[model samples]
Target: MSFAISSNDVRIEERDGHTYLIASSRDEDGNYNHTELNLDECLGNNEGSFNWSGEGFTGSAENIHLSIEGPEQLPILRAHLRDSEGNTHDRDVNLSERIVNDNGCLVFQ
Candidate 1:
């Protein structure tokens, strides 16, 4: 599913054995700057829930892509996916920043 963040809202998506959290803001140029988080690692730990945070931007969705990050902050990009309740069956995803997209679609970073 899709979610809208009123320039300051945080968004979370859980789907296909994974969870995605994104914090985004708009820029004067009308481009979205997004900070994304993957819950697979935390969820794999069997933790009930986890929190995520990131910076903000000031724009809209310029492009969509899947973003993957490792412990050292390495990023991997891919397509997007649809999020569903089954995705969160094992863990809870939380967001501390604003999100613009919450769908489970694979988005290439």
Candidate 2:
């Protein structure tokens, strides 16, 4: 499997003096997954796009995409990636409340 970051959906912003790029994924089972990659680590080179290809995910490889929105009091970044089956990924995470739920596909606190 190969992964490519779309330049059209990519975003970069600074908050609290730090930059972050929010990434997410969705699996064939309609499960949504998400992760945050610090700009300093992933975008240190300041490239306009990111692409990679290697060993396929051993277990389940979920479809992935990324979004960037911040530099304000409340950062709302939304990823529009889909899975192999074309299921949209959406998750709401509230750090302050320590609550997370992804359309009933995932739950965390």
Candidates in order have lDDT scores of 0.33, 0.30
**What residue pairs clash in candidate 2, if any at all?**
none
lDDT of 1 by residue, 1-99 (tens): 123332333445555545555556454566556655664433222112222322111011112233333442222322222223323222222221222
TM-score of each: 0.29, 0.27
Alpha carbon lDDT at 21, candidate 1? 53
TM-score, candidate 1, is 0.29
Candidate closest to the true structure, highest TM-score? 1
Q: Would you give me the overall lDDT of model 2?
A: 0.30
Mark the regions of model 2 whose C-alpha exceeds 4 Å error after superposition: 1-10, 43-109
lDDT of 1: 0.33
**Cα deviation of 106, candidate 2, in Å:** 17
Off by over 4 Å in 1: 1-7, 25-32, 45-109
Clashes of each: 29, 0
